[model samples]
Target: MRYFLKRFGFMALTVFAVCALTFFLMNAIPGGTAELILKHTFVGLEESATEEQLNQISSRYNLDDPLYIQFFRWVKAAVTGEGIGTSYVFRKPVLYLLALRLPATIQLAGASMAIAVLAGVSLGIYSALRENRISDHILRVATLFGVSMPCFWVALLLILVFSLKLKLVPVAGYGSLENLFLPAAALSLHSMAAVMRVTRTSMLETLGQEYIRFAKAKGLPLRKIISRHALKNAMLPVVTVIGFQMGNLLGGTIVIEKIFAWPGIGSLLVDSISARDLPVVQGCVLAIVSMFLLVNFLVDMLYTHLDPRIRYG
Candidate 1:
């Protein structure tokens, strides 16, 4: 209970800090909040809007209040579930926009994470079993290549090969599974590489353990020894890597989303940033942070199950 409480408290604090920083930074930018809101609200309105109109709009939105007061007001409303506020660009509730886009983001993240975990763990196990052989060496080189490649470059190259030349997938825009392959593959590459490397290292270390030798000497079949003993024991580090990669994939999907037009929260975040839509930006950040925290919390629980020594207390 104490450990969980402490972690939950930290997550709350992190969320508050992110919200404050996001709000302050958004306001501190060159454009005025009132002007941006009014301009976006009324299509034809521009910098030339009269002072009287500005005051009215500011007063209506409580934007004319002192900075600290505005912050507190927004925070209170947000915490109480009244809402963070409307988008400065879309003139709609920020949550509404997020709700619409969240599923698409979930789809991409899920697909990419599935790919990373499945292929990464498989490759890692194979490499460890073959330790120092030609296949292992080749796998290591591929892992290095994945880790070194920039995401955008990977995305572009995949598009060129699969979408443009091979006609195997769509270059951009989202709809069906065919539309998702190139982007998900691009997004999973780095994570898959990280997982593969970690798993290989962890599995190798576990396989080298004295207990592994005992299991082998006890007349256990090679398959049973590897599966029931080696892989199970080796999973702790791999779990940690997967947990971290899951959070990263959720946030990092922004680039892939933008490139593929996947309409995920990451793409929404980028659009909100470009438009200076602070509410939307804040909402997106809050959502991402919440997701990451949730994943870590689950991973923490998983630790106790994976390793009996990891007690909550």
Candidate 2:
């Protein structure tokens, strides 16, 4: 209970810090917020926004308030569910825009995470069991390739191969499961490689332990020894890598989402930034931070389950 309370308090502080930094840094951007909002909001119009219009926007959003005042106001609003404010570009509530996009982002993150864990762990086990054989060498090379390549480059490569040459999936855009493949693959490759390396290393070490040798000498079935003994112990480090990667995938999907034209928070954030949509930008940052923090917290709690020795105070 004490550990939980401490972590929960720390999480709250982190969220507040992230929001405060985002708010102040956003304000520090060059030019007037209202002017930028007006410029983008009425783009392609022959006439620019007049002084009166800019003033009205400023007043309506409390843009003229002192910096700290605006920050506190936003915090209050956020707690009340409308805290992120309205989008200057879309002219809608920021929360509403996020709500529309969150499901897609969650789906992408979840799919990518699933693929990384399943493929990485399976291949990792196979490679470890094989040791110095050709299959293990090949998997090692593949992991190197996965880890070395940039996600955007991987995304383009996947598109070129799967979407263009083979027509296995669409070039971009989202809807069907097929649409998810390229982006998820691109986003997950590095994480998969990382998990593979960690799992392989951990599994190798666990397999060499005295208990493993004893179990084998006692005529324990290979599958039972590996699954019930080796795998469980090896999984501690693997779980740590997985937890970190999951949080990273959630935030890193921004690039993948934009590349694939997925209507997720990543693409929304990119558009919002390009348009200088302050409210949307702030809201997106908040959402991403909250998610990342929440994932880390859950992973910490999960430690107790994975290892009996891991006890919280």
Candidate 3:
């Protein structure tokens, strides 16, 4: 309980800091969300972008308030679930915009992580069982390639092969399983590489342990020994890799979403930043931070289950 509480406290503090930093950084820019929205993003409103109108819009949200005051006000509003304010660019409730796009982001990130774990973990086990063989070396080289290549390039390459050449999936846009395949696979490749390497190394070490050698000397079937001893014990570090990579997958979607034209929070965030849509940016960031923290917390909880020796205070 103490450990859980302590971590929870830190996560809370980090969230508040993220909120404060995002809020201040957005306001520190020369123009306000209202001004930018009126002048740039919502250019259609430019005709009516009078000084009085701008001030009224700003005051309506109390944007003119001192930074501290505004920050506290936002915190209150967020805690109570009243509202997170509205987006200047979309002219919709910030939470509403998040709601609209969150599912797509979840779908993309979830799919990516799934691919990472399924392929990476399996391949990791396979490679470890065949360590020092030509196939193992080949997989290690491919893993390095996957880890080294940038996501955008991978995304484009997948698009070129699947979308452009084979026409097997979408070139861009989101919705349906078909639209998800390329982006999710592209996003997964890096994480998959990372998880695979960690799993292979961990499994290799675990297999070299005295108990593993003892089991081998006994009449225990190789498959049973692997399933019961090797894979289970080797999962600790792989779990950590999956947890951190889940967060990365969420954040990485910003670039991938734009490339694929997927209407997720990441793409929304990028567009909001471009338009100086402060409220939307803050709200989007807060959501992302919350998700990242949540995944870490869950992974910590999972440690107790994966390893009987792990105990929390």
- Summing lDDT over every window of 10 consecutive residues in candidate 2, give the lowest-scoring window: 39-48
lDDT of 3: 0.89
The true-versus-predicted C-alpha distance at residue 98 of model 3, in Å, is 1.4
* Pairs with backbone N, CA or C atoms under 3 Å apart (clashes), candidate 1: none
Candidate 3 per-residue C-alpha lDDT over 89-119 given as tens digits, one digit per residue, 9 for 90 to 100: 6778999999999999988998899999999
Clashing pairs in 3: none
For every candidate in turn, the CA RMSD to the true structure comes to 1.7, 1.5, 1.8
Compute the lDDT of residue 156 as modeled in candidate 3.
Answer: 91
Ranking by lDDT: 3, 2, 1
* Over 4 Å off, model 3: 41-50
> What TM-score, over all chains together, does every model reach?
0.94, 0.95, 0.94
Best lDDT among the predictions, by candidate number = 3
Candidate 3 weakest ten by summed lDDT: 34-43
Off by over 4 Å in 1: 38-49
